[model samples]
Target: MKAKTHAEEAAAFIKDDARTHWHDETLWHVRSNRDRSAQGIPEWETLRDTASATKNYVLSHLGELLEQFEANAKANGVEVLWARDDKEHNEHVYRILQENKVSNIVKSKSILTEECGLNHYLEKKGYDVVDTDLGERIIQFAKQTPSHIVLPAIHLKKQDIGEIFHDHIGTKKGASDPNYLTEAARQHLRKKFVEANAAITGVNFGIAETGGFVVCTNEGNADMGTHLADVHIACMGIEKLIPRAADLGVFLRLLARSATGQSITNYSSHFHRPAKGKKLYIILVDNGRTAQLGREDFKNSLKCIRCGACMNTCPIYRRSGGHSYNYTVPGPIGSILSPGRDLKQYSTLPFASTLCGSCSDVCPVKINIHEQLYKWRQVITENTNVDKSKQLSMKVAGMTFGKPVLYDLAGKMARTALKITPKSLVYSSLNVWGKHRDLPEVPKESFKEWFKKNRKQ
Candidate 1:
C-alpha cells in the first residue's frame, strides 16, 4: 500500500470542517492556558534558560553521565541496559518478559514504546499487552496509534470515545457523559492493573547523579502498574538524562505549565530502585539520537521534555492533527526530528510548518524548532529528489529575486496576468495554493513603481 503524504492526510483531516475547527480551538485554548500559567511565574524565562543550558551540558557529557548513571543504578539495585536502536530495545524488552515468564503486560503512556512499536511486537509474540493510561486505553480499544503525545486521543470527541467504549467495554451505546465514561475506564483498567505480569513506563527525566528516573502522569497509572506488576521496565531515550537531581526542579516546573497549564503533574513518581523481590530494568535507547546529536543544528531538539507545548502552539499541527505527520511524535518538533531519521521517507515533514516561530516561543526548553525546520528544508532540497514543478518554481523564484530589474518586471507581469486571467484558469488544478484561498485583487502598479513615484514627490 502506498503511504499518504502529509498533504493528503492533512487534507483528509480538514475535510471535516467542524472537527478541524474544534481541534484548532482546543489546542489554542491549551496554548492560552500556558500563557496564563507562565505569566503567573516570575521566573519562567529563567527556568527555560536553565533547563536549556542544563540539557546542553548533558548532551556534551552524555557518555560520562550514562556511565555514571549505570554505576549508580547498579548500586541502587536497578539494572541498566543500553539499546542502540529500536530493534535492540524491543529485543531486550522481549527477553526480559520471556525470562520472567510473563504473559500479560500493562503499559503506561510511553512515547518511546510507541516509537519502538513495543505493543505490536509483543502482541505478535502472543503476549497480551494493554495500555493503562486512559487516553492510551481509549486509542488501544480503537486499535489506533496516538494522534497526540500527551493527549493520545485528543482527536476523538466524548461521543467518539463513548461509541468505542460501548463496543469494547459494554458501556451503554448512547452514553457520552465524561464522568460516567471515566468511571467505566477506571473499572476496566483496575482489573488489568491487578493482572499484569509486567509494567512498562516512559521516563520523563533521568537523574544521572542519583541514577533515578521520574515518570510524571496525572492519572497515576504508571504507579499502579509498577506497584502491582512483578517486573517493572522503564524505557527512555538517551536524551532524557539530566546531570543532577536538583536540575529536575527546573524541568518539573516548566513541563506541566507548558503542557496543560497545571502547577505540576498530580503524580511525579520517582523510581531509584526495585522493591523487595521485584525486578526493575531501565533501557536507555538511542534510536538515531546520537546521529541527531552530531547534527549541530538539530541536536537541541533532544532537549525537548515531551511537554507538547510546541504542538499546542503550532498552527499547522492544530489544524492538520497529529496523525497527519505520520510519525510517533508529531508537529514542529517531529518535523525537525523525523527528517534526520530518514531524509527521503520523511522529506515532506519539514515542509509542513509555516515557519511562524510560535513553536520555539512556547517550547519549555527553548529549542530552536522553527530554525531547525528551515535548515532541514535546505538539506532535503539539496540531497533528495523533490518534485520537478516545485524545483523549477523555486529556481525561477531565486532567479527573479536575485536581479532587481527581473523582480520588478516579474511583479508587474504578475499584476497584469491576475487582472486579465479568467478566475477558472487562475484557480485551476495546477494552482494548489489557490485551491483553498483566493488570490488578492491585483494592484494598479508594482510597489517599486509606486515607491519610485512617491519618493520623488
Candidate 2:
C-alpha cells in the first residue's frame, strides 16, 4: 500500500473504522476487565495514588536512578548504550548489527522502535527486521503505521488481513477466519524467530534497584524472540524506570486491566541477566524525553504505561483515529508528549481533545491529562508563531474582552452579524460544527440586557 499523509490516512481510517460494529464491542469487552478488577480491590484508588506518586518521585531523581541502572546492567554482562535521539538510537543499533555482521533480526513489539523508525531504518541499511508480535507483524506486512498502541492493526478486519496475506504472503484467497489467519502468522514468525541471529524487544518496566527490564506480552513473543536469538537488544526510554520490584506490583495489578481489561497480562517476563549463551544488550534512549521530564506541567505524562486506555476511552481519539495526532504514541498521551519533541509540528494534537477527563479517570497512574492539554495550549500560544487566523483572532478577542464596554459592543455586533450572514458561512466552511450539530438560535434579547433591566424591579 502507498503511504498517505497523517491527516488523510486518519480521516479515511476513522470513516472506514466506524462501520465495524466489532471494534467498539471489542474495546468495551476489554474495558470490563478494568471494572471487575477495580470492584475487587477495596483500595484501587489508593493504589493509583501510590503508583502516581512513585512515578513522579522516579522522574524527579531520574539521573541518579539511571546511573544505578546502568551500573547494574553492566555488572550483569549486558552492554549498555545511551542514545541522545532517534538518529543516535538507530545508528547505535545499526552499528551493533554491522559489527556483528548480523543481517536478519526478530523484534517483539516496541513502540520505541516504531517511534525511531527502526524497522524502516534497518530495512534501508539492508537488514531484515521481522516483527514477531502478531499485531505488529500484521501491520508490518501491510506497510502501515499502527492505528492503536496495544493492538497495532486493531482497525483491520480479518478479511482485510486475509487479503493482505493473500497478496503479500501467498495465503489462499477467501480464508478470512481470524483463527486461520493468526495461525498462518504464527507459523511464519516461528520460523523467523528460530532462524534470526539477533532479536530486539521493548522494555515495559526497567527496575532501577535491580538493573533489569520487564517485557510483557500476551503471546510470549518477547520471551520466545529473546531466548531463541543469539543476540538480543531491548530498548527503553529513560522515563520507564521504577525504583523497586515491590513498586511494580501496584502497577502490574492495574496496567493490563486499564489497558486491555485483563486481570493481568499473559506474560510479564523480567530479565535481570542474559540467558546462558545469549548476548544481551539494553539501549536507553532519551530522544526528547529528558526535556519532557523538565517541563513541570507536562512531566506527569511520563507515567503512561502504553496501555492505550486513554485512546480507547477518548471520544476524539475514536472519532479522529490515531494518525490524526501524527505521533507514534497517539491519543491524549501523544498530545502532551509530542509537543516536547516539536511544538510547532504537533501543536494541533492538544487541540484534538474536547477537554474531557475520561483519559485521566482511566489512567492507572492518574495523569492529569486535561491539565496538560491546557498547559500545552498556553505554551503554544506564547511561542508567537501560531496559525495566522488563530493569532489574529486571539489578538482581537483579547483586546475586545479586556474592556467591559468593548466586550458588550462586540457581542451585540456579533449577534447582528449572525442574523444577517448567509447560512452558507455557518454551514460549509465552518461545517465541522454543522456536520454534527445545529448552532443555538440567538435569543430575542441579550441575557445581560434583560438581567440589568429586571433584576431589582
Local accuracy of candidate 2 as per-residue lDDT tens digits, 331-419: 88888998888877787788778898988888989999988998898998888477798789889999997998999888898889889
Clashing pairs in 2: none
Off by over 4 Å in 1: 453-457
Provide the lDDT at 56 for model 1: 89
Quote the lDDT for 141 in model 2.
87
Residue 172 in candidate 2 has what lDDT? 86
Clashes of 1: 0
Task: Look at candidate 1 and give me any clashing residue pairs.
Answer: none
* lDDT (Cα, tens digit) per residue for candidate 1, span 110-208: 999999999999888898889989999999999999988999999999999999999999999999999999999999999999989899999999999
RMSD of each: 1.4, 3.4
For candidate 1, the 10 contiguous residues with the lowest summed lDDT are 440-449
